[model samples]
Target: MQDCFQRTDWEVFDHQDLENHTSVVLDYIRFCTDNVTRDRCIRIYPNRKPWMTEEVQSLLTARNTGFRSGDKVLYSAAKANLKRGIREAKVAYRRKIEDPHQE
Candidate 1:
């Protein structure tokens, strides 16, 4: 991420010509592209939600695979399962919050 926003010294271009400007621009473009690729390769895991269990993640993966394989029925089923999981998780979370001593 730091590479994406790294600052470059522009003072070197003070005495440069159009060719130098073109080279600089191209280099900058390549730098940005490399940074983007690097960033994608480095997965930054977000703070996990209490409701996002392993089952939910598994279902999401299945859904993605189904969609990629162009299986509409499989994708629909996976999506429905994921939604149901989320809905149940939300309800359970709310219940836990409402009755702190229920556990």
Candidate 2:
């Protein structure tokens, strides 16, 4: 990247008008950065609920799948399990927050 910038003809953007020259230089820099940089995959976890654990997430997914499968028995069971899991997780989280030393 440094070598690419060093070899650039920066004098081409030296317009007499200050605004045009600044805009051109900024656009060139953005173009070079976009082309030279590699794309990255970043996993951003949502911050809506801190008590939402991986097990709870999997249970939620299972509940949804069961509901979509058109089976009343499976859906009902999954729903009950999800409700119990959520309640347990919330209680655990609250305890941890209120009494950090209790562990």
Candidate 3:
């Protein structure tokens, strides 16, 4: 288990690696925990308002797989994409609601 943890899974682990890593690890963990039917962990919704949104909530549910804020509790690479998607969605929704006529 320790070997698995210490293994060089990220041959090119970099800042972008961490940045792009968030959603990969997130989903992998989710897939694992889901298989076991356990709520392993939770996502950080610094401001609770966003998490309440249906879109946000769905992603947050994906975060339930298991992990700390900056750790891969499951698969690789999925974490980054997931976070980016969620962030963009939130910004888009906020803009759409704040000024429906602007866009």
**Best candidate according to TM-score:** 2
Error of 1 at 10 (Å): 79
lDDT of 2 by residue, 1-103 (tens): 7877888997888799999999998898888888787676746568748678788898999999998999999999999999999999999989988986575
Off by over 4 Å in 3: 1-47, 50-52, 66-78
Query: How accurate locally, in lDDT, is each candidate?
Result: 0.77, 0.87, 0.58
lDDT of 3 at 64: 53
Q: How do the predictions measure up, each by TM-score?
A: 0.49, 0.53, 0.33
In order of lDDT, best first, we have 2, 1, 3
TM-score of candidate 3 relative to the true fold: 0.33
